[model samples]
Target: MTAPGGNMPRREALPAEPNPHAQQLAEQLRALKDHGELSMRQLAARTGYSQKSWERYLGGSSLPPRAAVAALARIRGADPVRLLALHEVAAGTWNNSRTSTPAPAPSPSPAEAPESAASPESAASPESAASPESAESDVLVASGTSAAGAGIGPAAGRSLRIALGAGAVALVLAVSSTVLLALRLDAHEDGPAVASPVPAAVTTSAPAPVYTCRIQRVDGLWYAGISRTPDAEVAYGSTGPGVAEAQCLLRRAGISPGGIDGMFGPLTQRAVKALQKRSGLVPDGMVGPLTWKALRG
Candidate 1:
């Protein structure tokens, strides 16, 4: 269901005509990608721009960055001057649209607001101070007094205190007896000894996946079979085959991605950043389309 002139399927309709400049810019970019015979996903891979971003830019949902416009132009083998110029005009229009709308008037500050001549309830009397009456905050004192609003008097308070103290003693004795009984039972148990908890933590983790780089050409792109995804976005703390694939390719590129462990740890991220720097890409420590291309090579 792709558009006739573009590979993007049934392209989204542009926003209203208020941003004609932006809309025109998006149309032109869409044409460029179409002429290049590349889908938005492929464009992302070749241009280092995200597919969703291209969708927004081409759909006129928002203005694309200057770099994004230039990148698409490079991918399409077109000069970026015209697109950049159009982008400048669209950027101006976008900014104007945002600023032209009237904002709600701000409320006056307390100092600037009209003041009443007198406020009857502004000053509270000392008698208005109320004690908390919630049962959670209430504590019955042994000194012949209960919390305010709690109906218990001196004699009742003493009786309650005695009952609570007795309950506490009973609980302590129950816990002690249980512990003693357990110790005695454990001492008498006759069978194979229970396993120690010391090795539990060590055994909890499964082994990490291993990868071997079998670099080979596949349709003008190199793949190592770890993952064929050339545009899967990965960053620090990412995991799975994508991370492992990045590691395998990184190893082939002579940059260690730390044991090809599936986990994308700090060491793997540092290695990715290093690889990105060497490849003349932004050293973002993230694996994007461009970084994947570099690794595939």
Candidate 2:
């Protein structure tokens, strides 16, 4: 039966037994979506997959590709390996089912039957004709052998002389070619050598130096420094070298803090909030010890 909205019924309610592995994977994906508080549309926006595709996946109507599974797991911070294993099992089961399906038996072509049945009939004619032809061939061969034994005929002697003359001509042509090749080689050796043009070397730009983030206590306060230490709170509207360090760290964590001008702004706040959410902390748009630890970690 069709669903109330006229959509196809969900696979879960189907009569045929559902694939256990596919059902399990769909359950895990549903739980992950709940944990991330993400709707199908939101997931599509984040993962570039269509919302309807995700619906089919969650509804257990179809198996998702491995890449889709990986992308979902990455967004939800779930274990991709486990999900992929389930996908593999489901994919294998699908493949086996398709392979096990019985195919229609092949029918013999009309031309094949006629050709097979006519083979013996055709072969008998050739066999009957072969006997007389072979006898004639044998008589001819006996006559030729007797003629050859009774001293070479005039035609045979003429053929031998022609063969000898052709051999001599061939030998002469070969010797002439060899002499010409040697002469050419000697002339090439005597000539002055010509140098080939060399290609210019290609130069490439060097890679930028890597910035290592560190936390250190300086004087009487903490400062977040690049390749140094961290001992400061970088909140909205904060400005200093510490703020710059925080921005750098956020950028390193794949978050974009608007600028690295040592000024904390809304962009930086949003990045911090994202990090906080991922780190399972309260996202108050504040960069405290926990936020710093999450960033550094």
Candidate 3:
């Protein structure tokens, strides 16, 4: 689902107020002057003013004129409201000094001014880049100092450049990883879409059934009988003429005939017994001439 802002989603509302110290007004002006390598007198002349007046304002001795403030603000690219506040402070201090009457001379202390702040060298120059916040100070100095002292002055620019490079590399890696992950997810989501069924191609062909005959002995041989009782069947010594044909015929009647070789083995006898049982004849394994002739007939 999407919001009603056409194809674009509506953004959340932002806080109405902006920060008062967004540009750190005083700091920016100082940095700009330092970076431009200009003295207050030179800056004033560039914008049109006397050196003494420039000193009074920059030295924190007197409030700056509105024209001078506007000029400095323009050069520094700072908000006028914050710069105006600094002017007010300088004016108030100047007023207090002029109003105080000389009373007592009892307070002639040596520590009235900071030793570092009062020194001629310090008065003519600035502090070392190590004081205050090292990172911010280094940034200011790097942007202001020449290539020689850029160890402190050029630190901020270098760090920012390095940070931007690292961010670009990280963004590229993130985009590549996201694309690869999406491709893998899509492959999984649309798992194997092609399928085919196997076809049955079985071929079956049966052979013609063959028949064989048999006759043999178990303990003692008996006559192969038409009756189911083996005890009632008669015995015979030799198979008569046409016995080979009769054996082949008996083989067809589901009896083993020992390969139709005119003699019977135990295999033939066992087959005869199995046949007797199936035909309701005697199970005693035997085959006489009568049974043979009957099988042939």
Top candidate, metric lDDT: 1
What C-alpha lDDT do the candidate models reach, one value each? Answer: 0.68, 0.63, 0.45
Put down candidate 2 lDDT per residue, 44-77, tens digits, no spaces.
6566555555777777775666656877898987
What's the TM-score of every candidate structure?
0.34, 0.30, 0.24
Highest TM-score scorer: 1
lDDT score at residue 36, model 3, on the 0-100 scale: 63
RMSD to the hidden true structure, all candidates: 35.0, 31.5, 30.2
Mind giving the per-residue lDDT tens digits that candidate 3 earns over 43-144?
Answer: 644655444444444433334444456566777666767666755564444334433433221222567346533656435433222211223323433444
**Candidate 2, after superposition: displacement of residue 235 in Å?**
48
Question: How far off is residue 166 in model 3, in Å?
Answer: 54
Q: Is candidate 1 or candidate 3 better by TM-score?
A: 1
Ten-residue region with minimum lDDT total, candidate 1: 128-137
lDDT of 2: 0.63
Question: For model 1, how big is the CA root-mean-square deviation?
Answer: 35.0
